[model samples]
Target: KFTITDGRIARIETDTSAGDAVRLGPALPGLANVQSHAFQGAMAGLAETRGDTGDTFWTWREVMYRFLERLDPDMAQAIAAMGQVEMLEGGFTRVGEFH
Candidate 1:
């Protein structure tokens, strides 16, 4: 259980007697998404084509750099917001963004 005050977290307490305290559906708050490259999510699955050379990690990294170069502030913010919303919808309460 958690307590909120003044729009901030105030306390958390565990009690065995409060059966309703336990969430049974779509529960969040305990979930975490570590190693999250949120901006990369926008470019997911776009680095799988074989070029003159094979799709090596080096090639992928170059592609990623190109992608980054094309990112404007608004696009970056929109993509990041999208990632955060997806994480929250997927039940993640915390995330570590690597951008």
Candidate 2:
């Protein structure tokens, strides 16, 4: 059995009586995403190809800049929401969004 205090697990012990115990399904500890550029999620798969010379970080930044140029507040909000949903689905309970 487990006891929760202040939204956290405080104690765990073996219980002989199961009559009043609550049954919960499988559970796993959540993960934390320390750095997240959630707005960039909208650019997924948009700059994955190599250029004629070679693929470089500058080229990626250019692509990202172009995307940002056309992104409005509504689009940014949608992208951020999508990213947060993806994070939660991947077991991230805490996020430190950079943008």
Candidate 3:
């Protein structure tokens, strides 16, 4: 069993003990969501279609830079928080955020 508190696992018990009641459930390991540019989460599916010329990571970067030009600290934080929430809901316990 895995006991989580404050976004971390508090304890792991494989066998029941006498002092307290033991609860059994699937134990999930934390996962690091690597390779995420949190800023890109806001643009998911926005640039998937082929561009007039062509599109690739380079083109995507151009779009990303334009997006970053408008980001102040507060906007950045909000975007990061939203990304983290999405990662957590998607079963990621840790995030290796690139941006």
Best by lDDT: 2
Q: How close is each model in CA RMSD to the real structure?
A: 4.3, 4.0, 3.5
lDDT of 1 by residue, 3-32 (tens): 557854577777646555555454234589
lDDT of 2 by residue, 1-99 (tens): 766789667877785666676888665678999998988888988987776677689889989999999989898889989999999988899999986
Model 2: colliding residue pairs: none
Model 1 ranges off by over 4 Å: 1-29, 49-53
Per-residue accuracy of model 3 over 39-61 as CA lDDT, tens digit each: 78887776778777877889988
Superior candidate under TM-score, 1 versus 3:
3
Give lDDT for model 3: 0.79
TM-score for candidate 1, residues paired by index? 0.68
What is the descending TM-score order? 2, 3, 1
- Provide the lDDT at 26 for model 1: 49
User: Candidate 1, which ten residues in sequence have the lowest lDDT sum?
Assistant: 21-30
TM-score against native, each model:
0.68, 0.73, 0.69
Once fitted onto the true fold, the runs of candidate 2 whose alpha carbons sit more than 4 angstroms away are 3-27
Q: lDDT for every model?
A: 0.80, 0.85, 0.79
